[model samples]
Target chain A: MSVENLAISFGSNQVLKSVNLELHAGETLGVIGPNGAGKTVMLNIMTGILKPDGGRLVFLGRDILKEGVVERVRMGLGRTFQIPRSFRNMTAYENSLVGAVFGSGLTERAAGARARDILDMIGLSGKKLEPAGKLGLLDRKRLEIGVALATGPRALLLDEAAGGLTESEVAEILGIVRKVKESGVGVIWIEHVLQTMLHGTDRVMLLAEGRDVICGRPRDVMSSREVEEAYLGAGVGARTRRKRA
Target chain B: MGARTSGIRQIGGAPGPRGGWAARKPLVLAAAVVVLALLPLYASDYGISVGILIFLYMSLGQMWNLLAGYSGLVSLGQQAFVGIGGYTLAMVTQAYHMSIALSFFIAAGVSLAFALVISFPIFKMSGVYFTVGTWIVSEALLVFFRNWAFVKYDAGYNITVAYRISMPALYLGALAVGLGATALVYFILRSRMGLALMAIRDDESAAEARGVRLYRTKLACFLISSVYTGITGVVLYLNITYVKPGAAFGIDWTVCMVFIVVIGGLGTIEGPVIGAVIYVILRQYTYNFPGISMIMLGVAAVAIIMLAPEGIMGAVHGRFGFRLFSTERRPPPGTGPRQYPEDAADV
Candidate 1:
């Protein structure tokens, strides 16, 4: 999957002026950015939650810029929200069942099997009867990814899946992402946790001010002077200015 | 504890929501239908009248539940379809001198078409705006029908043929509609579309991301709901033998639907059944208090909503961990519960 020169704006606030990225099969492409860097916006456009003002999104040799969200999911592009959005009133099993039945258009019996497999995979088999609204944050986050995976997508877009987890919980999330990548599904992981991108990704892209500041091997990109000036350097300068003020 | 575990299995079984008495649901439903069908034969005239009210409100409340509880479309203008339905019966039977059989189909067709037409504007709004927008459309229609020469201006049209139909037959018709409405909700909730509808209700964008088509599913639900509401209206007007702009298109119908669904249960299948019974009994008793009746009903609705926000059925389900007419899909057998870390259960 590839996106080129994607852009969007609300009112006069230009969210994504122009952004580009590519994900090869079975690769984990980590996207790291500061607050309001258009990471979620880009994911939204790719998933068809929000339309890009101008861009090209090519998946499997087809320019799917015109496709809607459901059409995209059917075409094997699945996504999780930045703030986990599982169907709260439903059971954990039923949440996954929705994706298996509608996202993949499986028959009821087949969907039932698929949903069970997903819950087992996500380690929610015991809590299958529990309502999703009753699940803890870690479980809810796991269910978010589990629901997306139930669609049987070739590529998965995860938005801050480890946002509020503890160190061990974050490791568990990384383990699942590795398992997903090992299964030959391409991944675009947007994260604020620098360590995750450093160790978990095959490649890293730095997005600041709605533009790709750098993209390369994670370590190489992290060590670059441009990254320091745009990311850490800006942070230091802001703090020093605040101290003086 | 043992009972609770078995209850879990009953709901979680692969064939869906069956075990013990639940396994005999179909037989029970059939027997109830038989009894209701035979009701007018043994019941008095006043008893038959109350029975008709129960059936009609059940039909109306179920449709409202399907719209607000399942599809997440809270429409306050369902009265528009009801009014349209009653007037269609009047025009077909009285104005065109058509047979009663043809009028039922015409009323449904007209209501379905109106639903489609209003859906364009109303669907554009969401949440509270959609609610108000639907009420506005219904009010606009009320005004349109009042002045339109075709509907006899302010006077309204009467279904003269209603006099030709016997009370028992009308009761039978209401029985069919009430049973049909319940059956329709049951089957729809059990279908794959039912999952989609609940998903949409829970979260629209998430539902869409999971490949549930939003507009198409909503439109289908709206159309089905309107057709049933229209048919119920026909049965209602047939009973009264008179249709007027003020009464046929009044906000009273929407109030009854909302009251019944809210007081019984918002989304549960059994909610409307219980709600309709309570509503009918209250309405019948309140006739002696004429002026304060609407206020009394309002007070009753508020009290019920305050006590059981999910309605009586929801509160019952919470306390007992049981559901009848459930739309839940549980894991297959043999997938024993997995253990979670101790801290995970803290929340």
Candidate 2:
């Protein structure tokens, strides 16, 4: 999947301008920036939540800008929200079953089995029948990713999956992301946790003011002067630069 | 050890709290059906008429529940389809020379067509705007019917089908329609479409992201609801033996339906059934006190909203874990509370 020359504006404020990126199979790309850098908007456009003013989003060699959200999901693009919007009234198992049945085109029995497997994989097997509303925050985030995975996606966009978690919880999420990568599905993860992004991703992209400041290997991008000026401060950049030296 | 043993026994003896409730639901439903079927045989004429009224309201309440409660349409103009059904039945039976039984189907078709046409525009508005849009549509239909030439505008149309059919047959037909509509809703709720509807109800954007065709699913719900509401309208006017624009397209129909659904339970299958019975009985008792009946009903509705916003079934389900519909998932036998309590706190 690739986005070329993506642009979007909300009235007078332009959110994303000429944003370009390409995600290949089994690759994990980490996107980091200060708030209002259009990280979520980029993910939104890729997942067909927002229509760009000008751009080409090619998935499996077809322009999918006109496709609706459900059609895009069925076509192998899956996304998780930043706030973990699980169907609170439904059980975690039923939440995953929805993605499997409708998004993955599985039969009811097959969907049930798939949902069970996902809940188990997400480490929520014990609480599978619990209403999503009753789940703690970490479990809710896990269920969100599990629901996305149940869609049988070739690519996944995770928006801040580790935002409010502890260090160990962040490590757990990284492990899940690594496992997802090992399964040959491409992933674009937007995160504010710099350490998590730097350690978890194969490549990292830095965005500032709706534009890419740098995109390359995580260490190289972190040490670059442009990224230092745009996002990472001089102190952190110098420390990373000194460590690399 | 005693607690563990009792828990195991509970799981083994019944599925869960919800499961135990579900286990008896079918039997109860079957018994109710049998009782309703036998009512016309022994019931007095007045009793049968009241039964017909209850069944009619029950069906209308169910349709409104599906649209507003489950699908989140929140329409106040359901009387539009109701009016359409009555007018269509009148026209088909009198002008087209069709049988009264056949006119029911014709009215349904006409109402469905009307719903499909208007849904495109009405559904564009969300929440309160949609409610207002529906109300406006009903008012427009009422005005059109009032001015139209064929059915003798302002004077209204007298349904001649009432003369042909016996009161017993009419009561039986109303019962059948009520039962059929209720069953249709139950089966739909049990289907994939129903799952999609509930998901949409919870969160529309998230549901769409999970591959629910939002507009199409909601429109299908609107059309189905319109058909049933239309049929109820035909049954209602047939029993009354007259149809006027004021009564047919009146807001009172919508008010009663909303009250029945709210008092009974907004989204549950059995909510409308329980609600209709309570509403009908209350109406019957209060009909003798015309000035105070409306006041009493208003007070009851306000009490229900303030006390149990989720409706009676929702409150019952929350407190007693009763579930006749069995929509919730049953946890595996060994799964219960977490092993580490601190793990929950760390997150």
Candidate 3:
């Protein structure tokens, strides 16, 4: 998947300006940025939830901007929201089954098998019958990923999948991402958790003011001067401080 | 796991803790239908009249439940279809000189077409706007019919044939329509579209992102619901043999539907059945009160909404963990807990 020259504005407030990125098969790409940096906005545009002012989103060489949300899912582009949006009234098993049945367009029998497999893989096997609204935050986050995976996507865009998790829980999430990688599915993960961006991802892209400031190995991007200025304001950067003195 | 999946072809195949009742539901349903079919023989004329009203309200409540509970389209103008249904039967049978049997189909088609037409505008609005949009559409139609010479300029058309049909035949027709509407909802919910509707109801953006076609699924639901509401209208007007614009397009019809669904259960299949029965009984009992009855019913509805927001069936399901008409697929034995939380049982 590749995005080129993506731009969108909400009135006078330009959310994204000419952003671009690419994802290869079997790779995990982490997107890190400060608040209002358009990370989620970009993901929403990619998933066809929001239309960009100008951009070319090519998935497997097919421009997907014209397609709607469901068509994009069927075309193997799946996403999970930052906030857990599981069908609260449905059981965890049934929730996953929805994605398998509709997202993958699998026959009912095949979808049932796939849903079972997804529930087992996500470690929700014990609480398969539990209503999603009743699940704990950790379990809900896991189920979010499980539901997205049930779509049978070639590339999955996760918006803050581990937004509110303990250290160990984040590791468990990362472990699931490893399994996703092993299955040869590319992932574009956005996270505020630095540890997840540093360790779980193959590469990290630091976004600020709706543009990619730097893209490289996780440590390199984290240590870059641009990232510090982006996060802490330009006055806090070493070079800016020296010039001020 | 294999055993559970093997029965996937059945609607409620997975064996839950309440397996005995769940498994025997079909047989019980058949027996109940047999009893209802035999009601005319032993019951008085008034009893049969009440029965017919219960069925009509049942059909209307189920259709409304399908639109609001399942698909998240909270319509306040289902009377538009009801009125259309009633008026179509009148116009087709009396004005057009069409056969009564053919009028039933025409009424359904007309309402279905109306649903399709209004969908283009109403579908654009969501949440409260969608609800108000529906009410406005029905009101507009009401005004249009009132002035239109074709519909006798608001005086309404009377179906003379309604007198020709016996009470038994009318009761049978009402029974068929009631069961048919319930069966339609049951089958839809048991199919893949059922999942989509519930998913949409839970969260539209998430459902759409997960590959559920939002508009198409909603349109299908609206059309099905409208057609059934129209057909029920035919039976409804047949009972009265008199149809006026005020009576046919009255907000009271929509009020009855809302009251029935709310009193019984909002989303569950069994909710409407219980609600319709309760509503008919309550209406019959309150008939003597005349002036105070509307206020009394309002108080009752408020009490139910406050005490049990999920309604009677919801409270019952929460306590009993069983459904007479199950549309859910539970986990296999030992895979999960025997009993789920209230929400899981809601399906």
Clashing pairs in 1: A126-B338
Runs of candidate 2 with Cα error greater than 4 angstroms are A223-228, A231-245, B1-21, B41-46, B329-347
- Among all windows of 10 consecutive residues in model 1 chain B, the one with the lowest summed lDDT is B338-347
Ranking by DockQ: 3, 1, 2
| Predicted candidate 1 versus true structure: per-residue lDDT over A95-149, tens digit per residue | 9999888888888777777778778777888898898989999999999998998
- Which CAPRI level is candidate 3? acceptable
Cα shift from native, residue B141, model 1 (Å): 2.5
Best by TM-score: 3
Tens digit per residue, CA lDDT, model 1, B54-155: 999999999999999888899899999889888989999989999888878998999988999999999999889999999999999999999999999789
Report how far residue A29 has shifted in candidate 2, in Å: 0.9
Give the CA lDDT, 0 to 100, for residue A58 in model 2. Answer: 93
All candidates: interface RMSD: 7.1, 7.7, 8.2
Off by over 4 Å in 1: A223-227, A235-245, B1-18, B331-347
Worst 10 residues of 3 chain A by lDDT: A236-245
Candidate 3 lDDT, B43-139, residue by residue in tens: 9999999999989899999999999888888899999888888888898889888888887899888998899999999999999999999999999
Clashing pairs in 2: none
DockQ of each candidate, alpha-carbon based: 0.37, 0.27, 0.39
